[model samples]
Target: MAITSANQLELLQTAEAVAREKMIDPALVIEAMEESLARAAKSRYGAEMDIRVSIDRKTGRATFTRVRTVVEDDELENYQAEMTVDQAKQYLDDPKVGDTFVEEVPPVEMGRIAAQSAKQVILQKVREAERDKQYEEFKDRVGQILNVQVKREEYGNVIVDLNPGEGVLRRNEKIGRESYRPNDRIRVYIKDVRREQRGPQVFLSRTAPEFMAELFKMEVPEIYEGIIEIKAVARDPGSRAKIAVISYDGSIDPVGACVGMRGSRVQAVVNELQGEKIDIIPWNEDMPTFLVNALQPAEVSKVVFDEDAERIEVVVPEDQLSLAIGRRGQNVRLASQLTGLDIDILTEEEESKRRQAEFEERTKLFMDTLDLDEFFAQLLVSEGFTNLEEVAYVELDELLVIDGVDEDTANELQARARDYLEAQNAKAMERARELGVQDSLVEFEGLTPQMIEALAEDGVKSLEDFATCADWELAGGWTTVDGERTKDDGVLEPFDVSLEEAQNMIMTARVMLGWVDPAELEADAEEDAELEEEQEA
Candidate 1:
């Protein structure tokens, strides 16, 4: 292509301007123009066609040449080998397959069209490269702050110019209280980075949890040094936050370090948060105490855990209830997340009232026991002015349907009435004793006076006689007391003793007996008793 006149000059100027816009070198425009012309020539002319294209970047002059191929002795139209004498002379001398003959082909008036095509190629390649570069640069900055200038609003999203490129701030990402105009500078956190046809896009955020964490890291040196670890953080952005901190070293005070001298360090964080209040709590392994500290500025009386529910009931004094709960429950809500417990708050007055209700239930149970006793006494009289033996043998539930009696009432009455019969039985036993109940019938070891009296009525009169009887015949079990035993009437159970003491007692008794057979001993006792009777006669 040849730039022949005034029209060609204008195309070159436009190409330069576009190259500047796309950040491509101006000299590449000339190379692109030459390539385009070469292709156009080959398409316009066939196997006989030969063209050469070149351009002068400074003068915007472009030239194209067309010529016929030289063939050798072969009849082939296009030849790869040396040209024939006739063909080379017809075109030009010293022609070759890779060489071209020059002939002017640039349209005298359309040089500008050729330049425009080249400019388009340069612009497109430049844009694609720039897009790749932008993606790589912003990809690593996803959680970092980037300075942006407001451009214009398009389709409800604000376009921001980032010097080398542009980014969009969607309606949701832009903070409502903050506004921007053209050329206004603003700091935005890169929320996300995405690749698109035009370029790499960056999304920004003002409400991210990391935004607050980053702000604190910037303002507080202790956090950066790892002296204070933020164990947990919860925020109601723009208002308040509860952060749990633990010091790795025992010498450091985490809360004090965060708050600074005269509240300077934390105040800096507060200013960045637009005057939001921050409560820094020293974290603890004790869940109860940790929860109380998390809800600071509100005193807590107690924290009762419901382990199955993973919830805690916080008890605050009556005056501190509102403080613990905060405005609309914000304080407790944040504290719950900070301490990882679902909190249910109650005042002291409410807890006191609940305790009173439980106490009343226990009291009612005691009184019902007393009422059953009177009912049982009347039942016993109606059944018969029964002997003590008849009272003890009575089946309990058979008395439940007796007149106005219910299960609990009948049960209590039976127990109370049984006690009276047992006392009368004891007296009868004492009468048997006065009739000369043998000492053998009364000497059982560890037997209470009541158990001795009851046993004497059954003709078991002594420890020697009791020991000779089977355990089941006494209490029907191998335990110290028998199965017939009841709370209101039974032998007292043995007291606990050390193993050494028990072993000593058993050894002493065995040595004295010297392995005598129990059967022989019983027979001898009977014979001795008969001889005593004869002597008395």
Candidate 2:
């Protein structure tokens, strides 16, 4: 609507106020005000009229115009939006396509409804601008700590008021036993800023390990200045945590630097976390050495690793077992989390007993499964035979490499293993058939009879079901429980197909059943190129 000079200045002042309140740029607010006023002007003029408006950012002066584009007679489909060359000559100007013409449209007074409509538009624009600002500002601050005041709690989630916008410290991300009242000051790490249907969602976290690290950065000047680096951290949250730090300057001790004078530095962070204990350990590139450092005050006598299983066996002195394992296994558990290894703690005596037990168990297993005598079974167990799968999966050439097993004996041993496996598979196939296993699944060469039965039990009994099975599901992969790798001993050796083999088998099944076109699979290759093109556009 048309506005007097004083009214125009008042509108600009209102925009500035909204911008200040919303923490957005004032220019954007002025632009929104201009747009709102232009829409109101359109209501006063005709809805079909081509209307445009501009506001002076510096002087708060408003301008309005009824605009038209000069186009060829054939292009003048909308008479109100476009003007012809012959008609432009009547106004004494050069008539050409793509030329914009503007005529001053006197500003019109607004009714109550029009004023209310303008107010709604301004509010919407303010919200959109605020979302944009929050995204732009907080996106870069991801993983950084910011102190905020608790505004209120919603549905068990704490809402904290931040500089630009509010952030939600989600229920699960909060440390245990920590509670807050309104206006309580707390620091949180900016975990994420994501756009949602409602608006930008600012996610804050106090329980992330990175949050503890960030607090160390703030407290330790060496870390903030890049003289020291925080390599890794693991937290039991609100109870205990471990941090590994490395110093570039060899003269400086990373742990001592983090601990500060009389532990003041770490104690500051602990105070903020409600007395969470921090273990500052020196980091080492050698993972085993780092694990030793992480499990400080508890000596490790010996360390054995099973790389395939991603498990570590640590042997400590009999007296150190309780200390190394901590109260209820907290020490070993945190060490495992820090080093990214699954650790099993044992005393030296316990480890020796376990070894002897394993040896006896393996000797008996070889004697029974491979039809070997006590002498041969002892030889096989002495050479590290843990189970029947080891004998079944060992190469014939590798078997020749073992001591005391001559050519004839190795051949006989392998033949016995093969015969036993065949007999087992025959029985498994019979059971799978009794369970109504699909022929398509049974016909697949990659799956063993045991796997076929397992698949059938899981209801993957059709070719389509087999095709839909993920590679990890079809073959096998490790899962974790509380960050420790679960002992998934199924699907061992040749019968356990690689992911590529699983994918190939699924595609072969799909092709044989005429379920998918070969061309459709080929089209998946162009998907990345198409996505890049769409992103560029």
Candidate 3:
């Protein structure tokens, strides 16, 4: 194959120009041009014929060929593209099966219609190549900050020209107080890149917590150099934000570093955020101290934490309640987000009232359920026995460790607690049966009759329903109602079962129903955990 036309070199120059403009391999451009020529040649040579074209990248020569495979007469699949030895001898002196034979044909001129069609093919190929490049370039850059120019705005969405291609900064992703015009420059974080039918969607975000952190990293040199690190960030978009920072070096004050000289650095970030208020709090490994810092300006009277529940009760003065809670509960909400804990804010008076109510309820529950006097009930309450189950299943030594409680008394107390529990369970089982609770669930030790009744009322009538419940739905956990993750005031009340107990109950029900493989329960989990610890050691 050779170039006969004078303009053959022009093809090579055009391919190079398009490759450079599109930032693609020149070989790819030549290949796409080759395909476009092949499609054009087919129209002249009849669409049913196997016509191919090759353009030499160096010589700019275009060659056209009608291709055929040498095969036995009986094995020919297509009459036009396959030939026997009788026909093959005309092209090749000796041709074997599976060998291709090409016969050169005169190059067809690119007519008006063919030129138009070829232009479309080349454009489509270039667009696809560009999309591939965009995907490759932006895929790894996701979650990183980038400076972009607002090229266009479509229906409130800012379409920014990225380093390579166009990206979408959606309306919801923009800060609430910030609006953009065409050619307006802004800093955006690459949230995600999705391969869609149209092209790679490079989604940008201006309101992400990471975006703010990135801005701080730009404004503050200490964070960028690794002397200080951002531990966590929580944002209310353009209104207010909280960032927890820690210093790796003992001498560097992380908060002061972020605040900069006379609040200049922070004010720069705030200006970029459209006047968003920022709280740069020092992060501490001590959760109580960190939480106290997270809720700044409003002093915390006390922080009562339940390590088991990972919940915190913050008590503030009556007048400071509103400040601690912020406007529309923003302060506590941001603090919760920063700390990753479910925070309950109350006044000191409310804390006292709640404590008294809880104590009285527990004491009364013990006095009424067990055949104990008020003094004994109060004694059990003071001994940190919250419920009858603790009394029933606690080790005898634990009960004996309480002062004035002998082994005989502990035994008697345990017996009475068990009896009371058994009686309550019997009543619950009856109630659950009346409520149509499954018998398999009834046999599970961890589930109380009241819980069974609740499950039954909530359409969980079968073991499968109970098994498929999400850990959050089964046990209480965080809920996200809107775009943000905030607690749903009331979706489903949680079952008061410890995760281990819930696991045991679900395993028991499934095992009883033959839903789980029994072979999987070969090792005691505790023993397995200990073995894992030993292996780690």
Candidate 4:
């Protein structure tokens, strides 16, 4: 068949018809042809093959010629099998074994099968070349957005006609509320590029988290230039998103800078996201404060971090629970992902009950630590002293100056108070137990000796505190994790379960059914009490 530009165009039209009949693109056929020709040339002439061919504009006549290396070779068996001396003379000087020569090989049509085979080879080559070209074009644009025209829909997915080629914009990547028609212009972020048997495939997205980041870069100069840094982002895609941003320059307010004058900067991003709500939060090094800020519009009361579990528990108001959790848990989910914390949400009522129970548990512990022999802690209920906080916060001198107390008595009382406070602390461990806190101990930090005693004073005490206390307040009050104390220092290593979990096991063992009776325990306690009283007496 004749090959030329005019004929090629005619062939293109015919190929398009063929492609359409076969449910394929004519461009795909052309790519395959180019690839097949290159491969055939490479194989036939070796690295010395530099054959050049072009189709005539009107005739469709594809002229093929051979370009050969000027070298000497005798038996060119496998390479250029038919090289006449006259043909070899044109390209070479002194001919010998292993010498090279060039000769024009006429384009021969063996039969229809051979023609078909050549067409198939060309098609295959086109596909490979297209894949390589597409991979190169899109790999660098992985996280960037490109404007594309909607070409066609297949199996609910839209194929976008990009300038260089085409790409698939999966259904999931389509904005939830947006609809598209053929030829509609839309901006899509390049999610991935894959090389396939047919050609290079482009994957596009409209809902990825980086979509917002990319839009921000386009809208805000500060972002592209790296003046303002987007520390992290949490997105619900088509609904709402929270981004933590910080600026290296003190003069620039990161949030305001991103927001632009009257919300211009963020508005551009929101428009790209199809009216999605955007919340720009100021990033903080302080974990607690940052966590609270991240769960915005929900009014977080506190955040508790469990170092060993690498988790955070957020306390919010009862009404704000759903808001904090968001629809289908999007809020907390995004926040957890952004902060790299496993977040657990708690309501005010639950936190309140837990706080009360924790209070009672600590009081019982304080009572246990008192020197039952030399002294005893008398509950000062009449004076409104319910927990240790009332006691710890009160002036030591003032406490000693109370009626029935002198300076000597006061000093002794202070020492006793301190000891009682220390012993009440569940955080304290003997040298053997000093290794770690229990693995099941989620509220592993923030329980101060004073807080423990205070809780005890409130009639709150025991493992019940462990069971009921909200992680936030527990984390806020004191610390249980060991090692370095500063934020600048990296996180402490997790406490080993073998040593730490023993404390929880002991509590479990004591709570089982085979335990002694309270009355029997009271009688035994009375005997102990008698001994203590005698020692004091």
Candidate 5:
């Protein structure tokens, strides 16, 4: 193919046609043509020459030129493309080393092999331009709901046409066993858009919790207008879901707004989700109150929340136990997800039995440690004295309030409790010493004798070892593994150590060992205080 006057106008027409077909810029196609033509010209004029091609956008004229760069005498290498400073006199006057010399060259006639190569280069550039366009168009559309048409099914994945690009809905992302044929229109959530090696990948999902939330936003005007907000969503996909919503407008009931008149709005979302049942609960700042609403169709007798552990215990009547738990614990699981807490459901009878057992155990501890009779220990337990430390350090007035306990009796009780604790502490210290615990750890201010003993048993015998421990390792914490919460036992957890206290103590140890600068610690504390004040403001 020759770049002759007869075929000159055809280049622009071909470029525009390819650009329209690929949905890319016409300039990109023209640039690709320039490059492919340049490569062919280089092959004809000798590869060592600096041949170039430029097509005029207005007249579709191909202008061929050869560029030779001036260089220093010693740096000259290519005789066709470069000229030394002294050898460049014929081209121009005062030619600098970095200057380039250009002259018009005759266009090369592309042979069969060259034409084939040019075609491949144009195709490659057009494909790259198309990919870049698709990525830019869809990157910001993630987390949105889109109506797409299914193009085909590969394996079990559904390939959908996004008009400008293609999206993929994997089998696992579909609701239940929902299947679709070619040209089946479906609503999907744009889960993610990624630029991959082959091209941009648009991953769509119908089972995402956000998909249900987006559906409600489309159906409910209040949610769309920001009057009502979807706080959280938990889905079982094609089975059941729970959504927590809050309304900023006092006049609007979030649950009722979502339910709509005669359940019209929620029904639309349900139909789209393959008839999945949804529970719309009102959002509350109080976690327990919100959980009670989340676990609906069941009565809750009591709720005990452990804030530190992020766990909740719910007591219900025996008949309501199975209802609260639902079939295979689905109700409680959804409640857990909604409230961000691990939930344990129990019958009222079971809770009562557990409380009675705790009471009995406390009574036994008081009886054995304080040298009190059974009735006296029971009285102390009823007064909320669970441990000897509380009984020993409590005000004299608190002990006097117990029945038949006078000032003398209170003093005597405190004396006995203090003496027993001192003895226990001494025994723990002796055991810790036997285990080779160092004085640096024993002399640490925050740790008790029993804490030192526990540390020694756990092989944290030195100050360095304690300083290296993580805060969660000193204060027992719950870890989520494989979507299940597991307990991590801490050495000092039995002594009721808190995570903050553990952190402070470890920092102090590091400072003492010269591992951390005290000034830096002070600065960090000041920075944290400022951040807290800003948040409060």
Candidate 6:
């Protein structure tokens, strides 16, 4: 094969045909041909020669050239492609070190082996271009629903044809034991589009929670029009699911719109999900209220939310315990997912018993620490004094308000409580000193003696050590691992330190130790405030 006038037009024709078949740009195919021709030219000429090729997009003519760059004597490593500045004077009137010399070269005549190698190069380039086209086409289509046809099944994974591209619905992404034969049309959520070595991989999923949301968006006109928005969705695919929706228009009920007239809209989505039952709940700004709606078909007596831990405790009637938990805890699990909070469901009786136990524990603390009798301790506990610190520091009027407690009695009670707290603090300070706690940490202003002792026990004995600690490390936090939230115990957590307090204390320690500049912090805060103002505007 040769680049002759007869075959020059044929090159462009072939490029167009190949590009049309691959659904890629014709220019890409032409560029691939040029690269393959250049590679072959290098083989025909010296391997060290810098050979280049260009194809005219209009005339379909191939141009080949040899290129050599003039460089400094010491930098002229490639004798065939690079020349010294003096050596290039013959080709130019005045050539600099960085000047390039180019001359036209005859196109290579392709032999059997060369032609075969060029063909492989062109194929690889075309395949790469095709993959890039597919990736760019589908990358933004993620979280969307696509109607596709099943091509085949490899192992348990179903391969679906996405018209111009192919997608794989992994076994884990399928709803239940969904089995498909060739040519089965199905709707799937475009979970991800990834560029891999083999090609662009379009991962499809039928079990994703977003799939249900998209389905509703398609089935409900209000959702599609943005009159109602899907706030959250949780699914046990091919089984039960919960969807929370909010309506921007007051007249439009999001739940009713999603449910549709006579259950037609939701039924469409359910049929597509292989009979997955869906519970449409009205979305609420209040987390507890939303959670109550999420755990439907069960009555909630009370909800206790621990915001720092992102956990919630729900007290239901004894008979509703099983209903709230659902079969095998699926209801609670889905509700937790829907609300983004770890949930603990308990019966009313259990909550009452726990509250009583807490009350008794507080009563005992008052009796032992304040040296009060059982009845007097109970009275203090009932008056909302949980610890000696509160009793010691509380207003005298608050203690006097208790029935049968006079101002003198309140004064005496506060005095005894303060004495006990001081003694406990002195003992804690002694223990901390024994454990090598430094005065820098002890006199940090925010940390009490008990807090210092806890820090020392946890190997944080100095201000420097405290400065290096993270806020979560000192205030305790919940970590989500494998989809389950686990508690991380903090040294200062026992002192009732909040995350914000821990952050402030650590920053203060860092400033005191000269590890952080207060001025820089203030500037950063001002910049953040300005950015927030701009965003609001």
Q: Which candidate is the best by lDDT?
A: 5
Name the lDDT of candidate 5: 0.94
At residue 492, give the lDDT of candidate 1. 19
lDDT of candidate 6 over 200-312, digit per residue (tens): 99999999999999999999999999999999999999999999999999999888999988999999999999999999999999999999999998999999999977889
Clashes of each: 18, 2, 0, 43, 0, 0
- Stretches off by above 4 angstroms in model 1 are 2-118, 147-159, 168-176, 285-287, 305-310, 349-537
What does candidate 1's lDDT look like per residue over 240-317, in tens digits?
A: 888888999889899898899999988987776667788989999888989989989999998898653357999999
- Deviation in Å, model 2, residue 208 alpha carbon: 2.4
TM-score of each: 0.47, 0.73, 0.83, 0.53, 0.90, 0.97
lDDT of 5 by residue, 208-252 (tens): 989999999999999999999999999989999999999999999
Q: Give candidate 4's root-mean-square deviation (CA, Å).
A: 17.9
TM-score: the better of candidates 3 and 4: 3
> What is the lDDT for 362 in model 4?
53
lDDT per residue (tens digit) for residues 3-96 in model 4? 4344556755655565665445566665455444444554444545555454443444555566544333464443434454455665667544
Q: Report the alpha-carbon TM-score of model 4 versus the true structure.
A: 0.53
Could you tell me the lDDT of residue 131 within candidate 1?
Answer: 78
How many backbone collisions does model 3 have?
0
Candidate 2 TM-score to native: 0.73
Q: What local lDDT score does residue 167 receive in model 2, on the 0 to 100 scale?
A: 94
Candidates 2 and 6 compared: the better one by TM-score is: 6
Q: List ranges where model 3 is wrong by over 4 Å.
A: 1-3, 69-77, 82-99, 307-310, 392-414, 430-473, 483-495, 504-537
RMSD (Cα, Å) of candidate 1? 29.3
lDDT tens digits, residue span 1-537, model 2? 448887777877888788787778888888777788888988887787788888887777788898888899888887887888888787647777887788887777878888899888888888898888878888888999988999999887999998667899999899896778999999999999998878889999999999999999999999999999999899988999989999999999998999999989999999988788888888988776788888887999988876544568888999888888887788888998898888888899999999898888888888888877878898887777666667777877777777777889787887788789889889888887888887877887667787787777777776778877676666566788765576433332236466567778778888778988988887985897899999999
Task: Tell me the whole-model lDDT of each prediction, alpha carbons only.
Answer: 0.66, 0.83, 0.84, 0.64, 0.94, 0.93
